[model samples]
Target: MPSAPPPVPPPQPISDLPHLTRSPPLPDFFLAALSLFVFLSSSSSRSFKLPLLCIQSNPRRFLKTPSMSFSHPNSGRTPHDAHRLHPFASPQSLSDWLKPRLPSDSFASWGVKPGTKNVHNLWLELSEGETSLADSTPPIRTVQVLSLRIIDNHRRILLESHQQLSDGTLRNRNRPLSEKMKPNETPESAVYRAVKEELGSILGDSDCSEIVKIVPDSYKMKIEERNSASYPGLPACYVLHSMDVLVEGLPKEDFCTVEEEEYANSEESSIADEAVSVKKHFWKWVSLDSLDF
Candidate 1:
């Protein structure tokens, strides 16, 4: 059968066909050119964007420089001043800087209570990542304080002595009668509140109302100073509103007063009455000439 047509060479496998056999390897340049052509064709037809690759000798030189200036509506600080002041230049900056340094909870852990309405509390809240005081008036870093210059007929000034017990040791210092101005509280109201809170145990309500008198326009002065003593490293401005006060019913000589501080059993304790300990505060009267004023 004609040798069966050479066994008809069972249909040659498609992969084994002559044209399908591997050809000579392409030149490296030719293969690269073909790849570029294909890439350009695909890129022109595609709707997607390709990220631009910029080759720079100095990458840092091409990088954007961070701004050194900050602006606040109420603060008239210049850019140079802001740069120098740094984090204290703006409320947001101050909050950002203080957040990591201050305690997350109340200031009681710091051995003092700045009060519920104190500006330090506001800063603490802001540091806690709250935006409530972002648009409030007077800025967050500006602390308003009312200092009472209580004088007697002998010209002796009433100064409160603070003694804090830390690690079983007592640290003492003396300061004038002062309180932070509460939110929306007037200077006059703050003065009265401070008097009551500090002298309530010594003087009766009727005596406070009848005997205590704030001198009219008595050398009132407002001054701003950096507060380095209260919260160390806290870049805060203290706006002191000082006024002269006259109280008729106090000891002419130095006297001691104890303020009982009740703290919670734990740092996370929520119960208001779960007191674990008590701390005392001592007060006295000193001659005005003795202070540096």
Candidate 2:
């Protein structure tokens, strides 16, 4: 009788049960949208490709801009004005403009006439007051020079003597064969021209390729020096390009070569009025260990 009484109690509703509450079932449309979203996400992950990012370890290895082109303001000016001084405001501005142009192949190929004055020569004119620095301040100048470390199979470096004055003293320190780079000239072109000009007497009329080989991807350095000895009181920047040149069949002993240099009789003389001065260049090949520089 007691067990039948206990079983008589009715079952309690889920909403009325202790610690229990009824929850409405999720709508069909909501469930369907959720399933569709998950399915599309899974499919897209398999079907689409993500773009990859490449980072360069060395930022200097590439230029930031895709292409850079500069046109000289006096490119199309008359011949008289072509040689006129176009001074840069500062050393940084000059460096920025000249760096890219240093590797250019040719101005004529680009349909521009080459100016008479390169940076070095222009500085001479400006510093001498042959032409005004105009409204530009910080009248700094830059020069691009190409130097060659001519090496033979023996690893001996070739060096050339400085200009010998008539008074039997050297005008400057002995250094490697070098040349001031011309406007719109490539380093390769400047190398070829320098070798041909400096070593032509030794190499004869033979092609430069037959006599020497330029080592590719050689060391590069840039140095800024103030108060050049040549131009006193004037700050100068030297953008030097040094390259290794492999030469063949050169004399092991010392030798001599003659180079003709032109000088203005007076500070006011024009290019046409320059006087030619012929001087002898003494050359020697020394061991790498014995070299001071």
Candidate 3:
């Protein structure tokens, strides 16, 4: 008799990670709706197809401990405003609003004629109450222009954005940018400068890595006005920008966060460093396939 070979380790659960794939939307939304229903109704965390409408390609999910909040490259929005958004606007409608007519109530696409602030607001809402996320406060607008960089485990290109983080989180960065410097510049331009100063590489230079896209990833935000002395702007905007990319070399300590203090930094209460900055959210880049969509 012969002995059997050693068994292999189980595959990693991609359910909490995002993947890179360019696949067609499951057969028409109509047919997918049936599958969507069961997926949502079932106890399993996997996303369903249509009616339940849980279509996310990446599966990695983060709990958003204070260190993560992003925004569109425009005037920011309020938490009440996010929760108060009109129900008529579907994800498709919201995505459409970004391209053309970004209304006041919605965040319009960035770099557009009038503005796309609110059009991007609804975009943030789509990521709320998702499979693995806990209930979060409404999103907030950032006061400065932001520049976001995405890199793979090898520091390869992923995605980028020009929007800024709200003042509350700006102070959470490895190094804070001069908020007063770019008073009139657009967020994209402002971000480009900031990235250069912090990381010491010009993104637009011929030597820089090519950026895939700059998307205004929407996620729900929770906010409340406070009488705190720190956040000059008492009621600051909080946001989470979801960048799709490939990157590496991110040590958790390279970034700063107030996960232990956000809930307590209210009007009557106080947080030590009143000013929190966010140069990076420090994402855990697992293969998109690790996500269980």
Clashes of each: 0, 0, 55
Candidate 2, 181-225: lDDT as tens digits: 544456667787787776777776778876778888885757666
**Model 2 worst lDDT window (10 residues):** 61-70
Tens digit per residue, CA lDDT, model 1, 1-293? 34443445568887788778767789999999899778878866666466999887753321112221113223343323323322333334544544555555532333343211223333332322211221222222445678999988876888877644423335455788876554335576667777776666666554466677888887465756563344433345566778888987776666655443322222223322322221444678888888887
> Could you list the CA RMSD of all candidates, in the order they appear?
18.8, 13.7, 27.2
lDDT of 2 at 155: 67
The best candidate by TM-score is 2
The superposed Cα distance between candidate 1 and the true structure at residue 105, in angstroms, equals: 18
What C-alpha lDDT values do all the predictions have? 0.52, 0.55, 0.33
Tens-digit lDDT track of model 3 for 169-270: 222222123221122244445443434443333222321233333345521223333421221212334232222322223342333221233213222122
**Cα error of candidate 2 at position 103, Å:** 35
Deviating ranges (above 4 Å) for candidate 3: 1-142, 145-149, 153-181, 201-233, 238-293
| Candidate scoring better on lDDT of 2 and 3 | 2
State residue 250's C-alpha deviation in candidate 3, in Å.
10
Compared to the true structure, candidate 1 yields what TM-score?
0.49
Scored against the true structure, residue 251 in model 3 reaches a CA lDDT of 41
Model 3 TM-score on a 0 to 1 scale: 0.23
Best by lDDT: 2
Q: Candidate 1 at residue 20, lDDT?
A: 88
